[model samples]
Target: MNLFNLIKKDQEYWLVDQLKVSHIPNIEYLVAFDKLLTEWKEQRVAYLSLLMDEENEDWLLKRRFKKVSSIVEYTKVLDGSYIASNTFQVEALSDSRVTDSDFATLYDLCRSGSANKNKLFSIRQIMESLERELGANWRDQCFIFSQDSMNYGISIPHIEQDTTDEGRMFYFGVVPEQRCKGYGTKFHAISLELLKTLGAKLYVGSTDTSNKHMRRIFEANGCRLRDIKGIYRIDIEKEFIQ
Candidate 1:
């Protein structure tokens, strides 16, 4: 029905066609769409990506593409209502940075829920890469675990720092054994308070569509659904891309 030339000048995102037609949702559209990707594949685009709203009725039009991931985003308007002064302390990676060896400990604390899935499995790898990517803008943003089982973590983008986006972006994940113990909910609540105290007017977060517990945690913390996107990806294997 529709073909979108989803590309940018800087090429920050993958070059892909976002098909958005609904009336017919016919095979012809899919055939034509496949041709577009084929042409771009010859041009050596970084990856072939597809994005569709979760509510789109014409989803079957691109059913051939592999569904890699989906995101459900929420935003909390903060006026300091959720701030907790006495409970939970959050520190930034930049302010209270950890040594390479010490970061291993933090990584182990976070490993309860991080199985080798779609994401790169190494927590230390992610942490170091994020710290490097954010550079001066990065913050430690960790909870000092009084117990050995789990450590709660949050990433809040600050206005003062040269953070990429607007609003205080925050996210939290709990250990599997530690989950169902209200830690997720408590993390959201305390994060709201921390963001409020830091002068954040709004806090935004997102989770995978499959993560029901996180969805509930955000809802319990007064976050409202803002957007939903279904992301599909085709790996650029030399055999497949060609």
Candidate 2:
């Protein structure tokens, strides 16, 4: 058999499906992946697949699977980043104009830096995905940012209501390249402004603690370090037989 067929015949070989947007952290990825595998075991796929958000572009790792025994093995894999558990806070802004070019620029930047080299989707793809996942309720809570005359942009979706006194859940992401250029600050400000206009008293956002740039932006905006959570992962194939 060809190498492809040989690999396929291993039965042990697994296809890890990056689910794209479950919104849980790395440690959670293993739990969710395993649950999914078990729930779909009849499908006959031996390996586990993981799902991640497109915004988690920087945490990719190289393949490093080792055999520990006949059925057990260890693999150190990357599963994006983790967010510190904390109350959400919002910052009000005076502006609310985001352009499509901004999203295109962000997509290009993310693709350029991504390790997986998975093709980045167009603005339409993103919108469709969001609509399918979020349903019509998405319109009441989210908006697309874009430049004049351009139809492409990023989607800003709102999480559930914040449990904190602030009444702000969290916003997902800003464009990749547009980051660190003060656009995030602007975006946050604008989002807060909108939230305030909608009678919200505060807003909150989450990011990987390792993401110094984003942390810095949040700090500069008057957001304080509220909590920290450690993220962990285990290779099932490694843990199961051990």
Most lDDT-accurate candidate: 1
Deviation of model 1 at 184, angstroms = 1.8
- Tell me the lDDT of model 1 at 24: 51
Residue 73 displacement in candidate 1 (angstroms): 1.4
Q: What does candidate 2 score on TM? A: 0.42
Residues 27-52 of candidate 1 have per-residue lDDT tens digits of 56556656776765566554556655
Cα lDDT computed for each candidate against the true fold: 0.56, 0.39
Looking at candidate 2, the ten consecutive residues that score lowest on lDDT are: 69-78
Tens digits of lDDT, candidate 2, 1-242: 01110112134333333322335455555465446545434445444333233232233222223211111111111122212221233311113343444544544444343223122345555555444444565445554444443322232534323222232422334555455566555554445455454554444454554456556556655565543322222244553563
Candidate 1 residue-wise lDDT at 70: 78
lDDT of 2 at 220: 56
TM-score of each: 0.63, 0.42
Clashes of 2: 14
